[model samples]
Target: MSDSTAAWVAAGVRSVIGAHTQAQDAGRTDDVVALYTPDAVLELPGMDPIEGHDALREAFKSWAPTQPQLHLVTNTVVTPGAEGEATATSDVAFLQRGESGWAVHLVGHYEDTLRRHEGGWRLHRRSTTFQ
Candidate 1:
């Protein structure tokens, strides 16, 4: 891919990541699942790897917070590859609001594999490592 094409792919990958966090934070389970491929896999820190869109939807719904929550994603680095594939790593700060105030709930890094789909870029696999 040319440098310009690579740049565009990187931006698209980052957008997908950002959209996932935003949708989840807003408790939009369906929207969050839409960001992934139909057969996507989500691996959180503790639980087993949740496979496919149905499982992903259920997992996100079950984890919906009672209070406000936010996921701050930063330092995202995307590596473009052949065949419409890419990988990304990002630092994430998961925050939740309680009676006291907003506090950090978890600190983690994400390793993600993405692919260009008919609709757009979608996450094929996402693995989180908590710190």
Candidate 2:
């Protein structure tokens, strides 16, 4: 693809990563869900799929109290698609405040489908698996 197209895809993926970290750090569950499309779905291990914004909101609200101190995304690959759609995958690490300091609480990856909206790219679906 052209350099300009590649840069746009990178920017879109970066926006998702930024929103995730910012919302988690601030404990803004609403903001977290806002990064998703209204009909977005989230799938994580051992839990039924959370579909739509309302369910996504509740899921994030329940998680916010855990206060995961850090959200890190790395090794991202974004593939732009036709008609303003895209897909991305990234390695993620979640850190928590330990008695000593920040400790690795979880390691995982996110597989996402994103679509451009009025505001920019928004996640249409996200599947997360922790290891």
Candidate 3:
């Protein structure tokens, strides 16, 4: 890929990751699942991998936030792969508001594999490790 094309691909992948965090924070289960492929796999810390769109929807629904939540994603690095595939790593700070005010709930890093789709870039697999 040319320099411009590589940059575009990285941007698209970053957008997908951003949208996923936004949707999750907003408790939009459907939107979160839409960011992933139908057969996507999500591995959260201390949990078995959640696979497929159906499972993903159910998982998101079960953990839907009741309080205000925000995900601060930073230091994202993307690597372009052959044609339609790419990978990314990002640091995340998950915050939630409670009676005491907002507090960081989790600090983690996400490793994701993404693939270009008709709609855009979708996460094919994501593995999160908490710090």
Top lDDT hit: 3
| Candidate 1 residue spans exceeding 4 A from truth | none
The weakest ten consecutive residues by lDDT in model 2 span: 62-71
lDDT of 3 by residue, 1-131 (tens): 89999999899999999899899999999999999999899999889999999999999999899999999999999999998999999999999999999999999999999998776999999999999
Better of 1 and 2 by lDDT: 1
Score candidate 1 by lDDT.
0.93
Error of 1 at 109 (Å): 0.4
C-alpha lDDT of candidate 3 relative to the true structure: 0.94
Q: Model 1 over residues 71-114: C-alpha lDDT tens digits?
A: 99999999998878999999999999999999998999999999
Model 2: CA > 4 A from native = 66-68
**Estimated TM-score for each candidate:** 0.97, 0.92, 0.97
User: 17-125, model 2: which lDDT tens digit per residue?
Assistant: 6887788677899888878889999999999999999999888888885544887888888888877788998999988886788899889999999988776889989
Ranking of all predicted structures according to TM-score, beginning with the best and ending with the worst: 3, 1, 2
Quantify all predictions' global Cα lDDT against the true fold: 0.93, 0.86, 0.94
